[model samples]
Target: MTQNIRVVVVGGGYAGVMAANRLTQRDDVAVTLINPRPDFVHRIRLHQLVGGTGDAVVGYRDILADRVALVVDTASRIDTTGRTVALANGAAVGYDYLIYAVGSGSADPSVPGAAEYAHTMASLEEAQRLRSVLDTTPTTAMVTVVGAGATGIEVAAELAAEGRAVTLVCGKVLHPYLHPRTRRRFAKRLAKLGVSIIDGPDARVTGVSRDAVRLADGRELPSTVTIWTAGFSVPDLAARSGLTTDAAGRLLTDETLTSIDDDRIVAAGDSAAPSNLPLRMSCQAANPLGAHAADTVLARITGGQPTTIAIGFFGQCVSLGHGAATVQLASKNDIAKAFAVGGFLGAKIKRDSFPGLIEHLAHEAHQPGSYTWKFRDDTRRQRLQTLAER
Candidate 1:
């Protein structure tokens, strides 16, 4: 009789949960999922939570496969050579394969006083805290949002829709990823919603105080609440675990999603840096990468033919103030294209896509093997050639 394969997945986010669910479907494999929290945070809904538009949590029992064992402990250290994962509670678990899906965190604020005063919507707890603060605070309170990325825009718009005075501070113009036409549409919507877009001279946040945000050009914007959605940075666990990682602490993996230094270890989600194709830290890439990582592990274990994973982004969606949105279509390579939709239609598209993605993930978890697609060898070859030239 063949020995049962043991797969340990760290982190309960989208990638880890998906991987564990898929792995549990195989009777020959025993899967253990480790996470600090019992509930799975719908991280994508964090901005909505902060804006008091949605609940930012889902139970693990609702999504985790019945056959998979849920370990409620934080992964303190990974011993790849020993194939053991050390938990914070001093329990060590051994595994035949390990999946590291520990996602990234909100980037550290480099600006003086920003870290001390600014609240982030990176996690469920932080979002809830921000929401609580917003709910209890007076309606006339001034809120300042630092950054003009998708998260920043969404949060600012949501707050503005709630009749709060929101000032969006962007180092550059808002929605740089969007086409000029879309940007103008968003700007107009924000303006109509009474949200102030402070670009150029007032863009940079030099300091954050209890009552205001100091700009780089010596302008003090009165703000009772300062929210930071600037950027993200992966955890340092990858680098500390002796894994080959990029400067940002993302694990360096090959086309197969296996770490370049260790085939037994695989990485996905925000923490994976696959070859020259560094995917962004979003649900768009996380779900696909989770499936790819599971497939890679299954291929190696079952002695099946090896396959490379390729990712192709569909488009970008940014939600403006209530019932408004901007959808920027992109090529498979993620280049911005001419096709775009905005306003109510775009909002509908954004809202519809969430449930669709959830259903797709549920389907993939239930039937893992059926989702495999032929590897794009042409794209792989092109990526390799580009690397060589570099």
Candidate 2:
């Protein structure tokens, strides 16, 4: 009888869960997933949760494979030498191979008073807490949303559509990821919905207070509730455990997604910086990365050469209130193209994309190595060349 390979996947987010499900295809492998939450947090819809239009959660039973065991506990330290992972609850799990996919959260030590006074919708718990605060805040009170990214825009538009006073303060640029024409379209729609957009020098936030947000230009905006969606930072489990990592604490991996320090350890999602060329932090990329990471591990176990990453990206989709959205098209390499879709049709596309993501994960669970994506031929060749040089 062949000895079974034991694989322990950390973090239950999209990347971790997808890798676990994909690994279940091999009968000779035993898969275990460790996550702090019992239910999967639809992180992409977290803005909607804060906006009160979505629940932002789904039970793991809906997507996880039956063969994969789920453990509801936080990972504390990783002992690569011993091939063991210690949980926050004082439990240790051993693994022949490990997948590190702890996703990102609101960057810590954020602007002063931001953590103490401002609200964030990065995680399920944070969104729930912010929703509670929003329910109690007066409708006429000023709500300042700092950041002009998709998260901030969605939150401001949702609240403004509901007749709440909203102001979006863009630090320097607004919708840096979108083309100028698309940005203008979004600006017009937001303005029509009564969301005031503050950009340029006067828009830079210097500090956050209980009742207002101070600007770098000595201007202050009165705010009853402040929402911060500025940036994201990954957990430090890899760095704390003495694994090779980037400045942001994301694990460092080669082109095959295997850790530089140990071949038995692999990484995926926002927590992985492969070849120091990390993919954009989005669910669109996370799913593919997870699948690819699992393939690398399986290849190693079977004495086969691991495949290098050749991932491409689609555009960004942002929800602007209930019946409006913007789907910015992207080039094969993921540069925002000038063309975009907005209005009700765009909203429909956005809604369909959400359910499509979950279904894709389920399909992978049922048929491993079945979820495949496309990339331009030239882009694929270029990526392969880059990996060869590495």
Whole-model lDDT values for every prediction: 0.82, 0.89
TM-score against truth, every candidate: 0.94, 0.96
lDDT of 2 by residue, 12-45 (tens): 8999989999998788899999999899988878
Judge candidate 2 against the unseen true structure and give its global Cα lDDT, from 0 to 1.
0.89
Checking candidate 2 for backbone clashes, the offending pairs are none
Q: What is the lDDT for 65 in model 1?
A: 76
Report how far off residue 10 is in candidate 2 (Å): 0.6
The residue-by-residue lDDT of candidate 1 on 236-290, one tens digit each, is: 8777778889878899998888999998998878899888467767777787788
Model 2 stretches with alpha carbons more than 4 Å out: 1-3, 376-390
Query: Local error of candidate 1 at 4, Å?
Result: 1.5
Q: How many residue pairs clash in each candidate?
A: 0, 0
